[model samples]
Target: MTYCVGMLLDKGLVLMSDTRTNSGVDNISVFRKMHTWSIAGERVITILTAGNLATTQAVISQLEERNKAPSDRRPSIMEAPTMFQVATQVGRLLRDVIEGRQDGGMQGEGPRFTASMIVAGQIRDMEPRLFLIYPEGNFIEASYDTPFFQIGETKYGRPILLRGYDRRMTFEDAVKLLMVSFDSTLAANLSVGLPFDLQVLERDRFDPLHSRRILASDPYFHQISSGWSEALRQAFHSLPSYSFAEDSTPSDGAR
Candidate 1:
């Protein structure tokens, strides 16, 4: 499993994803789940994926092939007139890959394949946007009420975004928010691990403002995880407690 979030804010866009893949306690590995594409100042996009690894990989590979093709026949993400069209192309590609794999195997189970993606970015003249693409190739955009999208093992990290995220937050604050969110997820689920990929795109830049691969021992992440844990513990203790009076036969002494 994986954990990824794409957040849209008034300042810009923040994309984050963990790289861990776990099948069991002993079966563990790391593979990058975040991918990006750009055309200098014309357009930029990022995609974070979850669900069956094989299916996701194949879909991405197919997309890459088209991009690598010579001349104008490459079916353009870079040249798409609008961000919406780019998303449509990606959605259609995802659906094709899923269908091709599932139907290619003629049997009852048909080689089970399902995947979802969080896509975010902007074109030269368009506003930054975030989308959560479902396994069915449909997607929903992030809105003011909910300015973020998460994919895979999201429950544990969702609350932090829900509580603290705001449209006007700075790009710096957005990264911290994502780190705390990932921190909560790391504690509750073993499938999502560290060595995360993070990117921040300032609005209208049409490029990544900052990008980093956070390792297992990265100091900033370590600080965020530890600090958030301590804060949670402190908050829990500070809350007023409801205690049942000790069950005792005190009346017997009076009798």
Candidate 2:
């Protein structure tokens, strides 16, 4: 399992993905799940992958190959005319890879070779876009009604994003919100671990405004994890206490 979030903000896009992957407790390893491609002043594309490692790696490798040697054989994401087309090509490739692998494997386990991705980026004049691509080769773009996308180990951290996300928030605050979300997930799931990859792509800029690999020993993340835990404890304590006596229900404000 993994945890990857792509937040669509008015400023641009913010993405983070955990690096942990494992076949079992003793077989854990770290590999980057976040991949990005940019053409200086033309476009920027970032993908956050989750699920079967082989399936995801194959899809990424094909994309990189296409970029390095463009042709009609396969449409390179870098050459896709629009962000929508870039997402379409990636989704198609992901679906094909999974299906192709399954054809060579045993029955009743097609899902084990499946994967999904979050595609976020912008082309020259268009507004930045965010998409969630499924293993079936279909996708939906983020909108005001749904302003963010999360894949894998999503349950533990989803509530934080739901309650805290705001389109008008600053980039700094957005990253802070993501840290809290990732921290909560980290505490709840062993499959999702440290050294998260983070990126910020400002609107209209074909290059990343900020890019970083946050290690377990990173000071800022350490503070966010510890402080968020303490804040939750304090908030719990501050809530109105319950009473045992009959006819002692708390007031509406307390409720």
Q: How does each model score on lDDT?
A: 0.85, 0.94
**C-alpha RMSD of each candidate structure in angstroms:** 5.2, 1.7
RMSD versus native structure for model 2: 1.7
Tell me model 2's lDDT, rounded to 2 decimals. 0.94
Model 1 lDDT, residue 42, Cα: 77
Candidate 2 lDDT tens digits, 1-255: 999999999999999999999998778999999999998998999999999999999999999999988755779998889999999999999989988887886457898988999999999989999999999999999998899999999999999899999998999999999999999999989999999999999999989999999999999999999999899988887788787769998644333
Clashes of each: 0, 0
Candidate 1 deviant stretches above 4 angstroms: 70-74, 243-255
Residues 2-117 of candidate 1: C-alpha lDDT, one tens digit per residue: 99999989998999999997666788889999999987787788989998888889878877887887474767676678877777878888888888777876346533577899
